[model samples]
Target: MNLSRPLLLASNSPRRKELLAGLGLEFKIRVKEVNEDFPEHLKRAEVAEYLASHKADAYQHDLQNEILLTADTIVCLGERILNKPANYEEAFEMLSALSGTSHEVITGVCVLIKEQKAVFHDITKVFFKKLTKTEIDYYIRNFQPFDKAGAYGIQEWIGMIGIERIEGSYFNVVGLPVQKLYTQLKALGLIS
Candidate 1:
């Protein structure tokens, strides 16, 4: 596809990088350190979008002709937000909470082209079958899900066995809503 400007991906996530690359879109990785903190009032999906926009804001001055992309994903179970696990115990707790229950996986995407910017989000409902302590422990020990939200990756072994069903884009649960992002990019004339 022909693009009007260079594409810049402002993230260090390997999942996001792989997803963008799967779209056959050429982009350069340009990450900037940004605090992921959000307002205490923000809830569920709002938190993801706010953080994504915040990440984009860090490169506001650096955007010349490049279209910058930033994204954030969060796992929500009821009113609580399950962020990346800080340790093995946290991972276990997060997974245990999600076991045999339906939860929302929200991913917010930000596309910025100079002064013009578009921020949107996609939510996927994921249902997991009851997970035993042994299953959770084995998965954690083998996969070491310290870098993933909700203490798991939908593309991993836990997802394959534990996930009972899902409603909405699976890619969103993985990280980047590639289809929505592609459509948005094309609509913005960033890619053809």
Candidate 2:
């Protein structure tokens, strides 16, 4: 099986790299400056998916018969969308809102190769147990979850202690919907 077409990952996320590596497929990474902004009319899930596809559009020139994968994840609660934290106060606020509450984690995936393009989004409903002020403070002070959406990592200590339940793909919360991704990759002939 000489299934190779030069897979390229258009992201700078470590979690995305880890998840893709789990598929046992070799890939190279490249990123371009693409505007993450989306139209204000778009809602929660749409925001993530739209940005994902738009982000991949920056690498259209690099397609060259090679598949390019790009993704974006966001934590949405109520009408608010929580992206990566810009500062400690915002991170604290995001965590505080998420405590003892259920929120949706939406991850949007874009796979493109030449004229073929596929885009999809997955949603995971995660319920966090009532987190204490001290617990939140500890996680914020120690772990410094500035790079993760919603100021938390589902695979981290807060998730270990605070996550009560989840509905939908667990990997989605971790950043990539691996099973769905496998299906899409297979359908798109990106993998064997």
Model 1 TM-score, 2 decimals? 0.98
Q: Model 2 lDDT vs. the true structure?
A: 0.89
7-93, model 1: which lDDT tens digit per residue? 999999999999988888889999988999999999788899999999999999988989999999999999999999999999999
What's the TM-score of every candidate structure? 0.98, 0.96
Clashing pairs in 2: none
Instruction: Estimate, for each residue in 30-83, the C-alpha lDDT of model 2 and write its tens digit.
Output: 888888889999998899889889998888876787888899999998889998
Candidate 1 displacement at residue 133 in angstroms: 0.5
User: Model-by-model lDDT, in order?
Assistant: 0.94, 0.89
Q: State how far residue 18 of model 2 sits from its true place (Å).
A: 0.9
Against the true structure, whose TM-score is highest?
Answer: 1
